[model samples]
Target: MATHASAEKRNRQRIKRTARNRAAKSELRTTLKKARNSVKTSAQDASTATVTAQSQLDRAASRGVIPKERASRLKARLAKSLHKATAKLAAAS
Candidate 1:
């Protein structure tokens, strides 16, 4: 229970920010999952999904929802996995 006016306002802002961050994080997870699934399904679909997931990660980082380095690392890992999957498919054909 915040007694001071400023504290109350800060509390309110915190609540709003918390909800927003939670939603963004949830969306991020969904995008990541979609990208991973697409990688296992098709190369074309995986490329599109990876791009979408990378964009989401960038946006989340810029918005302060996730750290920049973490976003970069995730993008790199996604790209690497996609590349390996595509290469394996190509080699098979």
Candidate 2:
């Protein structure tokens, strides 16, 4: 479909970038899900998962896969959930 040589080059670049971005986004989602699941399991696991998910989110934001504020908001929510889970565990014990 690309007529010009420059257009063909750009098309190739777009395809590669799409794959890379998709992989990064998928990784981010997986990390986030793990963090959320860990919250329901245990505080220690939740803490580790939160850190990993936060790091992945930051990387995704820096790479332009997600917006900075969006990443920050998600991180905040994760932290809040982690805190609540930990507090509930502490109160129980």
Candidate 2 lDDT, 41-91, residue by residue in tens? 978889989999999999999999999999999999999999999999999
**On residues 1-93, what C-alpha lDDT tens digit does candidate 1 reach at each position?**
999999999999999999999999999999999999999889878999999999999999999999999999999999999999999999989
lDDT of 1 at 1: 100
Worst 10 residues of 1 by lDDT: 36-45
Predicted structure with the largest lDDT when compared to the true one? 1
lDDT against true structure, model 2:
0.95
State in Å the error of residue 1, model 2.
Answer: 0.9
Tell me how many residue pairs clash in candidate 2: 0
For each candidate, what is the lDDT? Answer: 0.98, 0.95
